[model samples]
Target: MSNTIDREKRLHNRTSFLSNIARQLGRTQPLTQVERPALRHTCQNEVMATFSQDQLKDELVRYTETSLGAKAVVTTKADLEATLKQLCLDYCKDQQGNAAAGETIVSATAALLEMVSPQSLETDEHKVHVWDAAAGFDANIKIAERAKVGIVLAEEALAESGTMVLYSQANQGRAVSLLPEASIFVVAKSNLKPRLTQATALLHQKASQGERIPSCVNFISGPSSTADIELIKVVGVHGPVFATYVVIDDM
Candidate 1:
């Protein structure tokens, strides 16, 4: 009898709470549909808008190098493969003192995978273990956890903030970029934008065109870092400790 009474009291309280909320909202029935206004920007920076494509790219490189503390390199399509290999050899290393043999994770972007050329990554002297992001989520997570380097392709790069916009998709999992010790993003010159606003606008336009928007969009300005503990400034606390951007000039 007591248990039944307690349950009834709880239900009464919940109904009363909901009734009070509805009363305050001045509506007897829940709203079924609501209209939202379009987004508008009243204040626009003319200077940023007026910059040429070359100027925007230059600013992006400068800010990426100085402000973000990430290596930014400009290469042509022909030299991209060689440049990527050199970067891996420079950064990825193993206990045997061989970088080419280091464990690496590469995103499954068609362009990126084509450039990766796993065969070229392995030489007679050293054979790097390269895993693709297309592997299942759990497998990719494990690979990323132990991988020395992670490679991804950026959809858009914002110059004003030196930010790379990464859309999480099947081919490019978020873990591939976040779980590794170091990350390298390949960005095409045509995808570089003058500001974050422009980049976001483009994404909205894509969505409006009925393109499937990614589950998540990550805007990475630099390597993961924090100064929370005694303000000592630690890097790679929650994500990649080192971030590098390779900008393809002729892409």
Candidate 2:
């Protein structure tokens, strides 16, 4: 009874004192951090449900219809190996100054060597790879020697629509996303999810556990493209003319 009364009075007194100080200071934030329990309360945000496969497909389709071109799904290791070879022979052959897509992956660089030009683009031992999804990709790929295209890994790519998600990190530099004209991505079957909302939620969950989200969170649909010039649809004016997404099954 009395205790409750005292607590109420104390809170009231505190509020009054702070309010007075605030008035005197004329916006007291620049000098000292003021008390605002109300502001802190707003920090708690509502977590939304992530997208399902169907939703992801829709997003992909929207992107493809506008820019991103054809996509392929690879289920086995053999498929990956074959695709790597195909990209080297096909994408690099005729392209002299063309910038293709960057290949994206979590790890494993067995076929990466083949994708990079066989020319002496490497100084010391670093091979000149046009685009590398693996972290710390410093080697310059000799596109001039073969073909110029970039490949990046999709954190999550929607199957129905063909959209790719690129979560930038220190290892995965911003250059991989920007410098290349074309982009190639490898989305493993294991990581494929349904929606963008869900994927953002997953990223949020990681951030909550004291993890830092990459500097860039890109949702690329297809090639470097722009319809901004005089409202005419121009491809490769802004980015690659062709961006391919290869869906692979985990082994």
Candidate 3:
């Protein structure tokens, strides 16, 4: 009888606690959420200073070849998709990782494609990797044995130092960049700006609204680099040795 009574009391309290949830949330109905609107500003400075075909290729090359020492190529949507497919085929040829390389590439790249756009990349491949890219942590572990290049969709940038700020969340994983030999940034032009000062203020504005910042706030200017010994260059010590920024211009 004592145990029975105690169980009933615990059940009652659980129900009562659940009943108070709506009041705590100030909701008589389901909570509706809204996205923050995008802010737009023009490039007041010289476009050439920031935008140049030569610099674009050079920057990617510097990070890919020297820093990360990656032999990555920049191409159109079609080219990237095809390249990924070819990579999978190569991996599949010898049953690498017991997976078709095409599937591994497709599995990881698919999630990225969906985040960037649905109609953008061809998705009907219907192939899935043994791992999922959205599972950033798990994916990093699985890809641990091989060279990996992570691409983060940055929310903002500071032109003063050519620094890019990537917010870590469900889509942006800590290991996605940290575990890879080379990490790339797909900077949405919509997030680009001319100054870090302005970006810091925006951060404060969000904080004022009681929004907690992400777990990891990264501001990267270049690859994982160090100059400790005789000021000589050593890269990819802690993280990716090479870094690339593929700036997607906003209209």
Summarize candidate 3's per-residue lDDT along 1-251 as a digit string, tens digits.
Answer: 55545555645566557558977988666544456676586453343356544454445445445544344344454354454443333333442444222222212343356544322322344233333445656554656425344455567755445566877665455565566555556554455555566667678676656556676678877677778999987877787766655554421
Candidate 3 residue pairs that clash: 67-241, 68-241, 68-242, 88-101, 88-102, 92-101
The TM-score measured for candidate 3 stands at: 0.52
Candidate 1: lDDT of 230? 92
Q: Where does candidate 1 clash, by residue pair?
A: none
Tell me the RMSD of model 2 versus the true structure: 11.3
Q: Candidate 2: misplaced stretches above 4 Å?
A: 1-67, 73-75, 95-147, 159-161
**Clashes within 3 Å, all models in order:** 0, 35, 6
In candidate 2, position 158 carries an lDDT of 49
* Better TM-score candidate (1, 2): 1
Best by TM-score: 1
Whole-structure CA lDDT of model 2: 0.52
- Name model 1 segments beyond 4 Å from true: 1-41, 44-47, 94-100, 124-134, 229-232
lDDT of 1 by residue, 1-251 (tens): 55546555655566667777888989688534345576485354444787776777899999988977788889988888788777777776665766445666777778777766756755554344445545556876887788777888999888888899998877888877888788888898888887777877777777556555687899998899888889877777888888888899987
**RMSD list, candidates in order:** 9.5, 11.3, 12.6
